[model samples]
Target: MLKKSPVSRLENLWDDSEAVGMSEPEKLLYRSNLLGSDKRVTNYGGGNTSAKVVERDPLTGDEVEVLWVKGSGGDIGTIRMDGFATLYMDKLEALKGLYRGPEHEDEMVGYLPHCTFNLNTRAASIDTPLHAFVPRRHVDHVHPDAIIAIAASANSKELTQEIFGDEIGWLPWKRPGYELGLWLEKFCRKNPEAKGVVLESHGLFTWADEAKVCYETTLRIINRAIAWFEEKTADTAAFGGEKHPSLPPEERRRIAAALMPAIRGMISEDQHKVGHFDDQNAVLEFVGSHQMEALAALGTSCPDHFLRTKIRPLVVDFDPASPDIADTLDRLRGMVESYRVDYAAYYDRCRHDDSPAMRDPNAVVYLVPGVGMITFAKDKPTARISGEFYVNAINVMRGASAVSEYRGLPEQEAFDIEYWLLEEAKLQRMPAPKSLAGRVAIVTGGAGGIGSATAERYLREGACVVLADIDAEALSATRENLAGRFGPDVVRAVEVNVTSEEAVAAAYADMAVEFGGVDIVVSNAGIASSAPVEDTTLELWNRNMSILSTGYFLVAREAFRMLKAQGIGGSMVFVASKNGLAASPGASAYCTAKASEIHLARCLALEGAPEGIRVNVVNPDAVLRGSRIWQGDWLDQRASTYGTDKEGLEEMYRQRSLLKRSVLPEDIAEACYFFAADTSAKSTGNIINVDAGNVQAFTR
Candidate 1:
């Protein structure tokens, strides 16, 4: 059980019952998971752990020691057994002989693959040598916030000595590689009694022969720092006290919704970007503080934090006392331009001859005073994770600045890590982005078959999808199903009745805050009505118009507003029907409303042409499978129109099609995908008849 404390403290969570009967590698994984479960201990994918386990060699048929460490790009909190890279310990030791020195230590990475034990294909990380060369059998290298606060202080070495004395040692800042590994090996040999070491401007590394001892020692050390900081900071105000009061939660969110799209539009010149807003207490406190700007400008201290957040954040100038969002937005372009110029200058000044060419000059993290922090990246999870890393940095700043002068990594050192050749190689190795990468899409009526299918298609192509529908239960189920497949960060849902103007507008606001902005709009929300012209009551006609025509119009109007605000151009795929192009008996109301939808698309296409917003139509007919409309009176009406019962209606429709095939929701989704994708870039105002070759619905 974790002990309750007045000030939050890292809990020692080792359980003897949980450890019983576990193998050595299993115990290492367990320890890693326990440590990583708390963000205070390590941010996502920010740490690595290892155990040297003796195993039977497949080739030699004899026992040999192997290093099982968290592989490159694996998160210890969620890693599986296979997520570890297994290498022969003797081969790793032999690498000491091949070491050319600190300057050439990068070559050591190339030799690691040669030492893969049991032919494990998991790639070893740069930190691999650090763990492999440690004299202790089990090692935990983590970035607990309290420990990092001490490590990132200007007087880090002194503080380390003052706090723990000889119980823990301290090391000068050195980039993690073969040289650092050798240094660690030397430190352990010189001070075998020390349980751990604080790496200046980096993080903590603790070790012991037993996995349980190593785990306990790591927690004990971090908890000590946490306790020490709590006592020392009891009377001190954090971050030089607050200079700006925080905006109310709802008000801050409203501001973020207005600003994110504008900022996203400017920074997305290279690629489409997704945004994440964090107004958590830590973020609000840091952004509202007097020292926030100075501390943020100094950049992050840890290599992991620096890489994700860039050398520093671009702090937006805004005041809650005299709020003027309009003025701030007007000045945003100039501010962004300045940040880009400064980043480029930094790149130019720090480039080694062998350094990769400059990457995106745009800042990843943006600090908004009195509001909170916003981060944008190639995708949603990255944006969210980047924000989490900055939060860790904030905790470090609060502690270090309160007790000792906070220190950021020197710019030159930051550049070295950011542009390291190995880092560039990792970037090059990434899979090519999918066609819809970074695109955010809203699918109205998203719980229905066609709408859900369209959202799935977009998700498969790497787009973040927002599902909008009035059916709360169905909407939640659809959102959960997609989120499970595509990750929660890339999928969200909002309860919206597109016919309601207020509801439609609010959904757009939610989208802006959740995903930065919108890129594609699938105006698919609709209802079907069938009545002969002589028998069509005013109520029936108006209901059809309300959902089929007015609803599409409402959603498209909101899409136009957001697309224009972002000024990045977007696609609007309106799911009309074949009846729009071909008159159908006994369905006068539905036909007229759909015809109006088609014409509306044409008008919007012409208006949006100059802005590069593309508008198109997909006319699907007789889509019977998994359709909610078909489950209602529309099914009986359609069957009666064809002179058939419900069971034979599908076959009759299939036989009536020129190709003798039935249409499916997935089929309509394909056309929507085309319209939403770049494949339809030059073909605005066009309509595709997906009725299996209907002569009456021919576009020509």
Candidate 2:
């Protein structure tokens, strides 16, 4: 049996302040958050909510009924007052006479803006009419996986009665629009006893006069469906095809590693349109199932999933227990080609003159037996979202399969949703993406001042960054900080002791496995040795030289090798020092090592030009902030040597520069960005000084 009421967890969170101060719209928003908080109820930005209330018009001060519906860009989980687009009820209801059916989709869409209650300019969801016509104070619509499983199944009406006992209403699949709303309103009026309505292969809608009642009603119905599913699937186990010997963990990782790079390469349209890959256990289990090919061909459980995952997933045949890598690779290539061909044919068959040119035909989901289902997208987050939805859809399919047989909306229905202008409008509302949208970058010493700053810049430009550093503590802190700004998965951290050749190679290899291949490499790992040539010990000189010179060599070598293998020319920026070009007193070891690094970049530039690779250097000086070299003993000694306080020394350096400005880590980071980005496409073997106009270090 279903839980008669919601768990009441959110009610505990609704403290006295919120409960006392809450208005009708806020109450509706609170319920939206409750529904969105549960993934089973709504995936990322997939549902809508609304409430009808009487409010005074801002200009007229006359009380009027209004429908405050969730706006286009508003996520239910994080909606606020501004996220609701309030429409005058009388104005919206008048549109009912204007809408006939699917033929009026464009007209209805065009007329919605004219009905705005306030001067609000936000675009409301297409389902606004569906909420407006319900005639209930509060209405909640969600794409719960459990409900979708039942609704998409062949025996949906039979199961609906068995589960809800006619307490819920059923609306056969109608494309959501003015027509859906009209149908739903008439059905609710005729069957006043119905607590909720299930839209076949669409989603569920539950409503009542009170906010809590509407929310609880939704929970009860969804839980009822879930209870039935659990009862029905209690004895069923995952299908894993014919049993083969399982590979060891290391072997599995190796297979995944090899498969990801090839998958990324195969799906990439070009260097500029490179995509990312991701997978999970559930995805692997589904892909490895004996009936995967048959079930997946039935199409997605719902139309909403078609936006992220195509109508049906592409299947690739492979046996992990087999030792023939060559054969597996050949099979993968052929399957990919076949998928692309089939996708083009599907597009040709369904495309109308008004339809947009076909999107890239690459299969978002690649089902590899014994390995897993790999999802591809232009970025990591999108790829991850695709993989998640695919897993959820598979679960729904399995549930349906267990009960009877899995069935879903036809391919044309999916195409209708996929190509609908209303659906595409949501995507068009987003700002243009950054230039490095699908690229990956790596920054050595990424926990330090310049490295961390550069990583942040790259992320802002829409590139995934790998922060490689030897300091575990600092690395964790930097990763956490950056992850908070962009996303948890955007900035990946790898522990790398630059002086260790093995560590350097492993770091690059790991990045290749994580994000396919590297596009930009910022070689910026080094230490300072400030001693008079006579006083400099062999240990001190060797220590500085090892990190400054040898570390650069190891990192650059591996990056070059990987870039060459991938056959994609890339960029590399070395963080050399101004002292390398302009000798400084008592800095022989540091200057010599930096000078060596600069010359190495020049040599690599010459070697890589033919292959379209570019190597450059940024020379920065007197950047003390966020510099570990300026802390502890170094700070005290430098201050003593300058015969002043730390601030005094900083001022001295600031005044010494021709520009009379203190050099900063961010200044160096900008130069690195120039080299790593397309801005320096025509230039290489060049050194850009970031020392606030250092005349002595000038190079032309």
Candidate 3:
């Protein structure tokens, strides 16, 4: 059993007058720090925090005590008082004796009266009992990224013992809430003097009488772990020649502030903000030369941290002067997809519940080769702290692995932590509103099959849609077909040449006025021009570019201005072509224009990111149904080029794709809806191929 020391810092801190009668302002500050520290320690909302206070009883003559644990769905970092769920301490303590096993959880819940469960408030923290079990005045629990790095190692216990020398107690990972609290209760009973405890594959729990001491102790323990690991695995020249980038501090600061509000909104608390980077030459050099595949498999430092830092770092292949931002972003998107697949596999192996899982990568870490690691945060302060913690975790994990292979938690265990009831409740508490509901969307070239299908899909998804085409008769026919299915208010018709700026602008303005404000703009209005490069006239080239490229720009710009003013994040989809991926004979103008639209969407994505705007391109290869450009002479030309009849040429186009089936315009529309909806929150600057896997363009 761990023995208690005569001078326990926690005891002293709690007994101090400053801690006992802290000012409201000071308490708020302490609360903010405690929440921020916990958020940093885990991925997303992986941990919980609480403050105990005495309240006057209305009927009784004495004061009633309650523990205000962070409510479910509320992130500790930005959580406010309302974000907490107040529970009677006495009632919580009684719950312990009623449940003997995991199976009894439901029974125990049923025993509580409706009054005992506060539906008006956010769901109670899952760890409410855990915090209540601890007799400390204040408690802080986190899956500290540093500790997990060590725990995930094969000889984690040995390494931890060597590093901390028995100062920290290690607890095996257990399902949180009642079960873990029971285990912790037993551990604390035996080791009364232990200053803090580390849960394997979970996080750290530290407490003291004073908020500051509690907060600092958590940091100290992490630092001690880092220092010990650094001493053992210090690489002298591994990171040499790496220097920080020459970005202005002001620019970094502004970006940090702009991001803070959103992050703060998620966590519900504010703390001092600062930014730091592993911009030193040595660190950059080391990261650049490191084996990325091996390093990424190390897993996240802590699960809660996932909400802020994501599962894996974005690896940048050492190019500081790349003019093509789109290409670089493509590479990143590929890496993100790989990470998502890995995450899905991990979830499938571990998940036991029916709850919907989040697909968004909560946080992103930059592993810039030849540049040191940089962790982005909602604010500068959190970013700097996160960077330090991340660096330490990396060093420790690498050192531990050097001695023996590192092993992460079992899939089920990670799932349990990630989908713990407390955290799940948080997700349920504040149901995020659909920001784009009841808005209008307009697709250009709606007379075409793809355009009409896309417009119909948008109407089905609750958006009032206007289908525009250059042919008035065709536009009217499409409106008649869709209006009966989607209802009269859901579909409208317009006829205009998308190539003419004046005509396109006038249409957009009228649509905005008619529909209130456009939320989605699908720039699908385009014409195909095919001729040998030498024979392609300048007039043909200009005509294609004018409609396909410049037209897209004009429509998207108008939508952006409208969305910004409406204070809503809007989505835009540009219909480019598979030819945008590569050059092809007799389609030089068409290919160039399509490529230009792709680039334009990429730029829009970046500019709109801050304002919650999303822009993506759909590259459809050979969508032939109802295409005006695929008729008559155009069809004959394409047929001749393929050495086949019109029917055979169409079959060849469809069969060339990996799936060997003709992709319907509706399929492309489905892909568009994904980008247009809340499902793709983190997806921006992405180009999805609706070509049935024909063109496997390399995304960064």
Local distance difference test, each candidate: 0.93, 0.80, 0.63
How does candidate 1 fare on TM-score? 0.98
Better of 2 and 3 by TM-score: 2
Better of 1 and 3 by TM-score: 1
lDDT (tens digit, per residue) of candidate 3 on 183-247: 77777778777667777756777766656666667767876765665565565433222333433
Instruction: Order the candidate numbers by TM-score, best to worst.
Output: 1, 2, 3
Candidate 1 local lDDT, 135-172, one digit each (tens) = 88999999988989999999999999989999899999
Query: Model 2: clashing residue pairs?
Result: none
lDDT of 1 at 545: 93
**lDDT for each residue of candidate 2 in 48-68, tens digit (9 for 90 to 100):** 999999999999999999999
Off by over 4 Å in 2: 1-21, 240-252, 270-279, 323-333, 509-516, 633-647
In model 1, what is the error at residue 572, expressed in angstroms?
0.6
- For each candidate in turn, the TM-score is 0.98, 0.92, 0.49
